[model samples]
Target chain A: MIRMSNISWRFLSVWRRNLIVYRKIWKVNFLVPLLEPAFYILAFGLGFQGLVQGLSYGGKALAYTQFMAPALIAISIMYNSFFETTYASFVRMYYQKTFDGMMTTPLSLEEIILAEIVWGATKATAAAAVMTLVLGLFGFVNFPQGLLIVPLAFLGGLAFGAVGMFFTGITPSIDMFNLPIFLFITPMFLFSGTFFPVSGLPEWAQTAALIFPLYHLVELSRACCLGLVETNPLLSLGYLIVFTLCFLVLGLTTMRRRLIK
Target chain B: MDQQPTAAGEIILQVDNLGKHYNGVSAVAGISFAVRAGECFGLLGPNGAGKTSAIRMIYGFAPPSSGSLRVFSLDVADDWRRIRSRVGVCQQDNTLDPDLSVLQNLLIFAGYFQIPADQARERAEELLHFFALEKKREAKVGELSGGLARRLTLARALINDPELIILDEPTTGLDPQSRHLLWEKLHALRARGKTFILTTHYMEEAAQLCDRLVIMDHGRILIEGAPTGLIEAHVGSSIIEVSGADQELVDFLAERKVEFDRMADRLVIYNKGNAEIEQAVRAGFHSRQCTFRSATLEDVFLRLTGRELRE
Candidate 1:
C-alpha cells in the first residue's frame, strides 16, 4: 500500500508547480477555458430558457437555465480535468520530456501519476469555482448547497482527470487525442443527462449512460444544487469514489510501464 | 571541512551484455561496461549508434531486452528507486519548462527529489551563481540563449548533488566558448569526486573530457581505452599532411614505398612523422605545404571506422 501522506505532499508540490507554470501562460490558457464555459452559460442556459418550457425533475418545477446551470458547472469541471490532464501530461511526457527529468530523481511513477491527477483536479476545481461565481452573478443558478458544490465539483474533476491520464498513457501521438475527445468525451458530455434527462431513452442507452461516471456526477451536483437530497446520495458518492480509484490505478500502472519499463 | 568517508576504488555501476530491441531490430546489442566510483566514462558514438538507448537502460528509463545492470551492488530491477535518487541525468533535449523562469525550473526539479522549498531555493541560487546564470534567474527559459539553457539543464541535474551524473551529448549545440565553459565546470565537478557518464559524437570532446571511453558503432563497442591509448593502438605514432600534390606526385607516392590515404587534395601519410614524409616528398615529388602532427582521436576514429559518412 502506498502512503497517503507521502503521496499527498508530493502531489501538492507538483500541483503548485503546475499552477505556477500555468499562471505564466495564463493569458492564453485561462482565457480559453474561462471563455468556453461562460459562452455555454450565456448561449445555452440563458438564451434558450425562454424558448423551452419548464421541466419537472424530482417534483420541482425548473426552467431550462436553472436545470442546466448545475450540469454546466459539472461539465466545466469535467472539461477542465480532461483538458489539463491529457494535453499537459502529453507535453510533459513527450515534448518537454519533463517527466523523464523527474523520473531520474527520487520521485516514483506513483508519485508522478498522483501529482498529475491532483494538478488536473486543482485546475478543474478552480475553473468550476470561477464558473459558479459567474453563474451566481448572472442570477442563473440559485444553489442552496453552495458548500457541497465545491467538493462535488472537485470529485467530478478527479474522476475525469484520472481517466484522462489513462488515455495519456496510451496515446502514441498528439493527433490520437482527438479521437478520444470527439468519440468518447463528446458523447459522454451530450448523453450523460446534461442537456436533457435520460429517463425516456431506450433501456440499452440508459444502461450505457449509467456506465458513464459523469452521469452520476451530474445527478449528484443537480441534487445538491436543487436541494433535493435523496436517501442514496451515498450510492452516487460510492460510484464516483470507485471510478476514481479504478482510473487512478489504471493510470498509475500504465504510466509505470511507459516510464519505468 | 566536513570531510566524508569515501569509497576506495569501488565499482559503483556494472552492465553485463545489455541489449535493447525496438520492433525487430536491435538498437543496443550485447554491449557491456562498468563505471568505477568517481570515474568519468564516456560512450563515444555517432548518431544512431545507440548511446541514448544504453543510457536510458542505465537510468531505468527502459528495461533491457536482455542482460543485467547493477548499481551500488543492487540489481536495477529491485532497487530502481534507490538508484534513481543517487543518479542525475541531462538528456540530449532541453526538457526545462518553457514558461518557467530559469531559477523556477531548477526549484521545481528539486521539489521532484522532495527537497523542501526553502532548501530548493537555496540550492537553485547556488547553482545559478556557479553556472553564471544568476543574472538571468527571473528570465523565462524560452527567452534564454541556447548556452544558458544548456547551463541551466546542467544545474538542474546537480540539484541533489548526485553520486553519478549522466550527461548525454551535454555540449551538442553550444558554441566553442560555451562548450569550453561547460567542460571546465564538468572537470571541476569531477575533481570534487563526482562520477560522470557522458556520451558524445564529438571525438575532440571525448578526448578532452573523458578519462576513459569506449568507441561504439552499430550498437556495439568497437574499442575501449583512454583516448591516447586508443589513438596509439589504432593510428600509430604520428600523421603527415602533404598538400598541393599534382597527379605526378600522387602517382610517384603511390608507386614508391609510402603508406598514405588521400584526404581531399592532401595526402595524409599514416604511421610516420613529417620529417620522413618531407624527405620522401622532396626526393620524388613536390608539394606547397607539408606538416606533421601527433595522432588524434579523430584519426583513430577514421582509421577504425573508415571515412565513409554514416547516414
Candidate 2:
C-alpha cells in the first residue's frame, strides 16, 4: 500500500511549510541542539579532565572530551528527532490541525508522513552539522571519518522519527504521551551509552540497552567519529536499518488510518 | 422570475444510492442527488444527521461505503486525486495556518497545486481584493477577527479557480453581519458561473442561497427540491398557528376532521388550498393568538420528518 512515488515532490511542499514556520520562531532556542552539546562537552570535558588526565572506554585510551564528544553528537540527533517528531508532530496533527488541513488538497497521507519524517531528519542533521563544526574547531574530530557520522545520524533520526510518529497516531490524548517519554525515551537516553559505556553496565542492563535504537545509534556514531571499526560494523548498521524500515512501515500505516478518515 | 430552478442544467456531480458507515454505524444511507453546473446546491440536515458525511464523500474526505459517486463525470473511487485538484473545500473549522500571514497563507496553498509563482501571486492578490482583506495582508492569521479569518479561508479555497467549491457549514458561528457578508461573497461567486455544494442546517440559509437542496434526516434524504418548491409541496402558501386556548382549538379542528399537529401550547394547521382550515382557525381561535405567514423549508422539514430541522 505504500509507494515512494506517491510522495515524490509533494513531500517537499509539506517540508517547505514546516521550514517557513520554523524560520519565524528561530529565535526561541533554535540553536538548543547545537549549544546543549557544546555545554555538555565543556562541563564533562573540563570536569572529568581535571579529575583525571584521560578516559578509557571499551579498552581504548582517549581524552575525556574525546570520548564524550562523540556520545554527545549522537545525543543531539536523538533529542532533536524525538522532540520534533513527537511533540512537534503531535501539536501539528492534533492541536493545530495542520495534517487535517493538508488532506483537503491533493496531498495524500503517504506524502504527509514522508514529509514529516524528512523534516525531523533534516532538523537533526542541521544540529549534527553545528556539532561537527564545533568538534572540528576544538580538534576533537577524526576529520573526514567524522563525515560518515552525518548520514548515519540522519538515518538514526529516521528510525526515531518513525517511532515517535507511531505513538503520536495512537495516543488517546495529549497526556498519554508522557507514558512513552518517561518509560521509553528516558530509558534510552540514560542507558544508550550516550553518557557512559554500555559495556560497563551489568549484564542484564547491557542486554536491554542493545534493544534500544539510540544504543545502536550511539555505537555506530561514536565508532564513526573515532575511526574505530567494530568487530562487525555491518551488524550495527544492519540493526539500525532493520529498525528504521520496521518502524517506518508501522508508524505510517497507523498514521494513515488516523489521518485519512 | 421563477423561484424554482428552471432547468437541471449539465450535471457536474452525480450520486446513486451512496452510503457511508463508520464502525458498523451508518452515517449516510442510500441517498442520491446531483449537482449541476452554476448552481448553489445544499445538503440541509441537523448536527447528527448525514450532511457532513455526504459532503465528505463528495470531496474525498471519506470514501463511500456503498453505491457510486462521481464528480465532473469521473468515478470517485478511481479519480479522487484528479477530483480533488479541481474541487475546492472550505472546511467547517478554521484550517488556516496561524503561523503565516494572510497573503502568505493563500500563496502557500497555491503552491500545493504547483500554481506558477507569478500566477499564484496574482490570484492571491485578486482574492484579497475580492474579500476586502488587502488591508490585513501582512497580519498573522490569528490576528484577524473570526469573520476575516473565515473570509481568508474562503479566499484560500479560491486560489486555484476551482471548478467546483464545497463548503461545509461556512457560517456556523459567525455574527449576523459576518454571515451576511459571507453570504454576499458566495452570491457574488455564484454570479460568475462557479458551481457550489454546501451543507447547512439553517433553513433561511438554504432558502436564500441554494438553487436546489435536500432536507436530509437520520442518514437519508427525507425530501429534496428547490426551496420554494419543497415548501409549496410539503406545506403550502401559508400556515396558521393558534397558541393558548389550544385545547378547544385542537378539539374543534379534530372534530371537523381537519389535520393539524399539536404541541404543548400551539396548534398548527396546514393549508390544503381550501379556506376551511384557515376559516375554521380564524372562527374558532379568534380569542387566542393567531398568526399567518408564508411557508419555509422549516415548515417542510417539520411536516415531512415530524421534527424541527434545527434540532
lDDT tens digits by residue: candidate 1, A1-261: 333432445556667778887787677866655576578767976677778885766567777777777788888889889987899888888888777777677666677788888888888887777777777776755555655778888888889999999998888887899999998899989998788777657989988888888888888877766765322567888999999999988887677666664
Q: Which portions of model 2 show Cα errors greater than 4 Å?
A: A1-5, A50-54, A229-231, B1-8, B308-311
Question: What lDDT does candidate 2 reach at residue B299?
Answer: 78
lDDT of 2 by residue, A1-261 (tens): 565545668778888888888888676645776577678878887776777554567578877787778778787787788788888998888877777677778777788887888788878887887788788778877778888878987898888888888887788877888999999988888888777677668989978887888888878777788875322567878998999889888888888778765
The residue pairs found clashing in candidate 1 are: none
lDDT for position B148 in model 1: 92
- C-alpha DockQ of every model: 0.64, 0.67
Off by over 4 Å in 1: A1-11, A23-46, A133-144, A202-204, A229-234, A253-261, B1-5, B243-259, B262-266, B272-278
Q: Grade the docking of candidate 2.
A: medium
Chain A TM per prediction: 0.89, 0.91
For candidate 1, the chain B TM-score comes to 0.91
On a 0 to 1 TM-score scale, where does candidate 2 land against the true structure? 0.94
